[model samples]
Target: MGILDGKNILVAGVTMHTSIGYKVAELAQQEGATVIVSNFGRAMSLTGRVIKRLDPVPALIELDVTDDEHLAGLADTLREHVDHLDGVVHSIAFANPETALGGRFLQTSWPDVGQAVHVSAYSLVALAMACRPLLGRGSSIVGMTFDATVSWPFYDWMGVAKAALESANRYLARYLGPDGVRSNLISAGPIDTLAKKAIPGTEEFNRVWGERAPLGWSTTDSVPAAKGVLSLLSDYFPATTGEIIHVDGGLHATGS
Candidate 1:
């Protein structure tokens, strides 16, 4: 039997087939979990088309984390598909191009910075709070993060957002722990995703990871990170919470 058999999982932020969220959903299905994807507006149609590729096509639900109406309706929308969720993956992140790239850290506007933090970092808290009613003991919440401890060339405000995400993970863990629900993040290396293409200097970071990381790196493959996410969602990491698991080909541990 697959490790996640009978589990119901809600995964968000699947924009394209190559997205890490897509890979996680695919693997979660393969491991016997019943997966439901969350997207909103234009993205819902895209996810609807993409999920057809799975053996048992999963349901798609609307969830715009920034919208209070959507957040208020999340648990109810999810209940229509499954009674409750065993796990939820927060894979959504975005920033205005101006705030994200081209060395605009000093010049980025307050609104742009707030937008970045809201979507990339605060959404995790928003998602957890929205989905908590559907989750219970043994349930896990996972989010995607980059190595936020250091700065990157063109990462700028998104880097700051990630740091906030890391901090949020800890607080979520602390508050949710009493309820037996776990919160964690997977700090993945640069992978060739549509989101990565938007960052101006991701190629350089990918190259550095390939050279400096002990396990080398694969910008084309997200399966390793996907596998790590599934492990956390499964019974394997029952006691783990508020942890940042690095699936970066050992880059985070190595010195440049």
Candidate 2:
């Protein structure tokens, strides 16, 4: 039997066929979850093309995480599918283009950092809470993150936001645990996603991933990270929470 048979998953941030969100939704379905995807305004058309890529098209929901209207509307939208959610995969992130792409940390303004943190880090908490009424026992909420151990070139405000994301995972786990809800983050290595456009030194991250990762690295395949996301979405991680599992081909463990 599939690990998530009859379960419903809400995957946010699918923009294109090459998107990591696309890969996660694809694998979640393969693992037997009833997947519902989410996309924003201008990106809505792109999501339709991505849905066609799925073997059996999953339902699509409109969600722009930063919009209060979208947040309030989510529960109603979810009602069209199942009454509750088994899991949520948050692949959403962003930064003011000007604040990223090698922008100096000192040069970034609070408005830009606020936006970065709101959309990327704080949304995880919002996602869990907004779905709380619908998520009963055994329901999981998983988000994506980078190492956040140290800063990377061109990462700028996004890096600071990821640190907040890491911290938020712990807080969510503690607060949500009593009710059987779980929160976790997948610290994936640098993958070639639209989000990566913010990182100024892209070539450096790619080179580091290939050299430091003991298992070797290829940014082409997001399947490994997709699997990690699915693992947390399933009952397999029953006792796991407030954790940041690395899916970076051992890059985080390498010395020197």
Candidate 3:
């Protein structure tokens, strides 16, 4: 039997077939869970195309993380497809090119930083709150994060944004814990996705990770990280919440 058999899940941030979010949705279904997807604006069309790739193509919901109306109406909209969610996968994050690459951390504007944090960090809270009505006992919320404990070359303000996301993950766990809702993050090693392509110096980042990580690393393979997400979303992590599980090939524990 599949680990997630009979569970209902909402997966957000799928923009391409290579997207981690897309892989989550693909695997969730393969594991016998029903999946619903969400994307926004121009990405909506892209997600629609990617949805065609899934075995039982799921429904797509509109979710512009920055839009108050969208966040406010999220649960209600999701209700149209699935009555409730047993798990929520938040594989969403973004930063303006200037805030992410170009080594402009010192000169990065507040507006850019604000945009990054809002979408990449605070959106976690927003998503949790909107999906609150659907999440209940034994429900899980899993998100993706880059290792934010240390600054990486060219990551810049986006690094700051990821740190905020890590902090937010903890807070969400505390607030949602009473209701039995669990929140966690997977700090994955660099994987080749459409989003990673936008980063300026990912090649060197990948090379360094491969060299330094004890288990080695594969930028083209997302299955291992995707499996990590599935584990958290399943009943396997019953007592775990507000935790950052690093699926970085043991890189986070390394000194060099």
RMSD of each: 0.8, 1.1, 0.9
In candidate 3, which residue ranges exceed 4 Å CA deviation? none
Deviation in Å, model 1, residue 124 alpha carbon: 0.5
Name the better of 1 and 2 by lDDT.
Answer: 1
**TM-score per candidate, chains pooled:** 0.98, 0.97, 0.98
Instruction: List, residue by residue over 1-256, the lDDT tens digit for candidate 3.
Output: 8999999999989999888888899999999999999999998998998899888989999899889999889988998998989999998888888554658788888888889899999999998898999998999999999999888988888889899999999999998999999999999999999988898877878888979999999898888899999999999999999999999899899887
What lDDT tens digits, residue by residue, belong to model 1 across residues 53-166? 877888888899999999998999999999999999999998887565658889898889999999999999999999989999999999999999999888999999999999
Which residue window of length 10 is worst by lDDT in model 1? 94-103
Structure candidate 1, residue pairs in collision: none
Measured with C-alpha atoms, the lDDT of residue 161 in candidate 2 is: 90
lDDT of 2 by residue, 5-82 (tens): 889999988887767789988888887888899988878888987799798988888888878888887888899987
